[model samples]
Target: MLSFILRRLLSGVVLVVTISVIAFLLLYAGGGDIARRLLGEDASPATVAQKASELGLDQPLAVQFGTWASGVFQGDFGTSWFTSQPVSDAILSRLAVTLSLVLGATVLIAVVSVALGVLAATRRGWIDGLVQVVSLLGTAIPAFLIALGLVIVFAINLGWFKPTGFVQLTDSFSGWLSSITLPVIALSLGGIAGVSQQIRGSMLDALRQDYVRTLQSRGLNRRTVVMQHVLRNAAGPGLAVLGVHFVGLLGGAVIIEQIFAIPGMGQVAVTATSQGDIPLVMGLVIATAILVVILNLFVDLAQGWLNPKVRLS
Candidate 1:
C-alpha cells in the first residue's frame, strides 16, 4: 500500500510538471504582444521592448521557463501584468470559492447518485423510472439554463438565497451555505444524473455475478451481501465517474461564477486570460493541474482501497 501511494505521488508530480510545461509554452509563446497590451496600444516600440526585457519576456523560452519554474518552487508566482497582484495571492484568495462550489457539488453527487442508483437497481420499478426521468432531464438541460431557472425560482421568487455574490465562511457559516446552495445544485444536477446511471449499471452487473448467487445459496443476509460485496464492486465504476465529474464541476464553475458573480478561480481565470496576463494565467494553469493531480491521486487511493486486487504498479 505504501508503495502504491508512493508510485501515485510520483506519477502525480510528473503529470503536474508536464502540464505546466505545456501550458507555459501555449500561453507564453503563442500569446502575442502581452507587454504591448499592458503598456497600451499608444506605447512606443522602445517602451514595449523595455517592458518585455524587464519582465524577461525577451528571454528564450527555455531560460524564461527555467526562471519561472525556479520561482514557482520557492512559492513565487510573480505579479499579474494588469492587476500587479501577486499571482499566488490572486489565485489562492479565489481558490476557496471554487473549491467550495466544486466540493459541495461533488458531495451532493456522491451521496445522491449512489442512493438513487442503489434504489433503481434494487427496486426496479417506479423508482427506476424516476431515476431515469431525472437522469434524462439533467442530461438534456444545460447547466447555465438550470442555474438561471434556479435563480429565478429560488432566489427571485422564493427569496431562499441571494441570487448573486458570494459569502465567506468566516463571515457567517449559514450565509456561506445559503450563497452556494443554488450554484452547487446547478453544478451537480448533470453529474448526479450521469453518475447514477453508471452506478445503476455497474450494480446490476455486480448483482448478476456468480458470487451473488452463491451468497444467496449460502443463506447469507441479502442486505449484508448486497451492501458489502455487491456495492463494493459497483462503487469502483461509480468512483471513476465521480472523479471525472469533479473535473467537470471545476470547468462548469466558470459560467456559474460569471452568472452568480462569485469570486473564484474560474472568474480569475477568465479575467487573466482575457487580459493576456501570462503570469496569472500560468499560475492558474499550474494550480489547476496540481489540483487535478491531487484529485486523481485521491481517486486512485480510494480505488485501491475498495478493490485490493487493483494493481497500483
Candidate 2:
C-alpha cells in the first residue's frame, strides 16, 4: 500500500509539472503581451517594458516557467495583476465559498440519487418510470436555465431564498445556508440525474448476479437482500464515479458562480479573464489542473481498495 501510494504521488508530481509547462506556454504564446493588455493600447513602450520586466514576463519561457514553478512549491502563485496580491491568497480566500457549494451539492447528490435509484430499481414498474422521468428532466435542463428558474420562483415570486451572494458561515448560519441553496440545487441537479441513472443500472446488474439469487432462495426479505447484499456490491462503481463527480463539481462551479455571483475560484477565474489578468489566469489553470489530477488518483485508489480484484492487478 505504501509503495502504491508513493508511486501515485510521484506520478502526481510529474503531472503537475506537465500541466505547469503547458499552461505557461499557452498563456505566453496567446495574443498580445499581457503587460500591454493590462496597460492599455495608448501606454508608452517604456511603461510596457518596465511592467513586463517587473513581472518577469520578459524572461525566456523556460526561465519564467522555472521561476513560477519553484514559487509554486513554496505556495506562491505569483501576484495578481489586478490587486497586486498573491494569486494564491486570492484563490485561498475564496476557496471556502466553493468548498461549501461543492460539499452541499455532493451530499445532496449522494443521498437523493442513491435513494431514488435503489427505490426505482427495486420497484421497477411505475416507480422506475417516474424516477426516469424526473432524472431525464434534470439531465435535459441546462444549468443556467435551472438557476434562472430557481431565482424566479424561489427568490422573486415567493421570496423564500436569496437569489445571489454568499454569507460566511462564521457570520450567520441561516444566511449562509440561504445564500447557498440556489447554487447547490443547480449544481446537484445534473449530478443527481447521472448518479441515479448509474446506480439504477448498477443495482439491476447486481441483482442478476448468482449471489443475489442465492440470497433470494434463502427467503431473505427483499429489503434485507437489497440493503445487505445488493447495495454493497453495486456501490463499488458508483462510489468510484462519485469521486470523479466531486472533482467536476469544482470545475463546473464556474457557471454556477457567475449566475449567482458567488465569490469562489470560478468567479475569480471569470474576473481574471475579463480583466486580462494573466498571472491570475495561469495560477487558476494550474491549480485546477492539479486538483483534477489529484482527485483522479484518489478515485483510482478508492476503487482499488473497494474491489480487491483491482488491488491484486
Candidate 3:
C-alpha cells in the first residue's frame, strides 16, 4: 500500500510539472502584449517598450519561465499583473467558495447515486424504471437551465433561498448553506445521472458474480452478502467515476458561480484567462493541476483500500 501511494505521488509530481510547463508556453505563445494592455491603448510605443522591459517581457521565454518556476518552488506564485495582489492570496481567498460548491455537490452526487443505483440494481422493478427516467432527465437537462429553474422556483417564486450571491461559512453556517443549496443542486444533477448509472452497472455486475452466489450459499443473509461483499466490490468503479466527476464539478462551478454571483475561483479564472493575466492564470492552472492530482491520489487510495488487487497492481 505504501509503495502504491508513493508511486502515485511521484506520478502526481510529474503531472503537475507537465501541466505547468504546457500552460506557461501556451500563454506566452499567444504573443499578447501584456505590458501594452496594462499601460493602455493610448500609451506611446517607447513607454510600452519600457514597461515590457521592466516586466521582463523583453527576456527570452526560457528565462521568464525559469524565473516564474523558481518563485513557484519557493511558494511564491508572484503578483497578479492587473490586481498587483499576490497570486496565492488572490486564489486562496476565492478557493473556499468554489470548494464549498464542488465538495458539497460531490457528496450529494455520491450519496444519491449510491442509493438510487443500489435500489435500481437490487430490486429492479418500477423503482428501477423510475431511476432510469430520472437519470435520463438529469442528463438531458443543462445545469444552467436547472440553476435558473431552481432560482425561479425556490428563490424568486417560492422565496426559499437567495437567488444569487454566496455567504461565507465563517459569517453564518446557515446562510452559507442556504446560499449554496441551489447552485450545488444544479451542479450535481448531471454528476448524479452519470455516477448513478456507473454504480448501477457495477452493482449489477457484482451481484451476478459466482462468488456472490457462493457467499449466499454459505448462509449469509441477503443484506449481509450484498452490503459487505457486493457493495465493497462495486465501490471501486463507482468511486473512479465519482473522482472524474469531481473534476467536472469544478469546471461546471464556473458557470454556476457566474450565475449565482459567488466569489469563487470561477470568477477569478474567467477574468484572469480573458484578460491575459498570466500570473493569476498560471496560479489557477497550477492550482487546478494540483487539485486533479490530489483527487486522483485519493481515488487511488480508496480503490486500493477497497480491493487488494488494485494495490498489488
- Give the TM-score ranking, best first: 3, 1, 2
Q: For residues 36-130, could you state the per-residue lDDT of candidate 1 as single tens digits?
A: 88899999999999999999989999999999999999999999888889999999999999999999999999999999999999999999999
Candidate RMSDs in order: 1.1, 1.8, 1.0
Best by lDDT: 3
TM-score of 2: 0.93
Report the Cα lDDT for residue 91, model 2.
Answer: 81
lDDT for 50 in candidate 1 is: 100
Misplaced by over 4 Å in model 2 are none
Q: Write the per-residue lDDT of candidate 2 for residues 1-313, one digit (tens) a residue.
A: 7677777778888887887777778877664688888889999999999989998889888898789888888888889878999898888898788889988998899899899989988989999999999999998998789999999999999999878889999999999999999999999898888889889999999988998888888998879999987987787778776777887788778999998989899889888888988789888887777777776677668767767676555
List where candidate 1 sits over 4 angstroms from the true fold. none
lDDT of 3: 0.93
228: Cα error in model 2, Å: 2.1
Q: Spell out the clash pairs found in candidate 2.
A: none
lDDT over C-alpha atoms for residue 50 of model 3? 97
What lDDT does each candidate get? 0.93, 0.85, 0.93
lDDT of model number 2: 0.85
Q: What is the lDDT of residue 14 in candidate 1?
A: 94
Better model by TM-score: candidate 1 vs candidate 2: 1
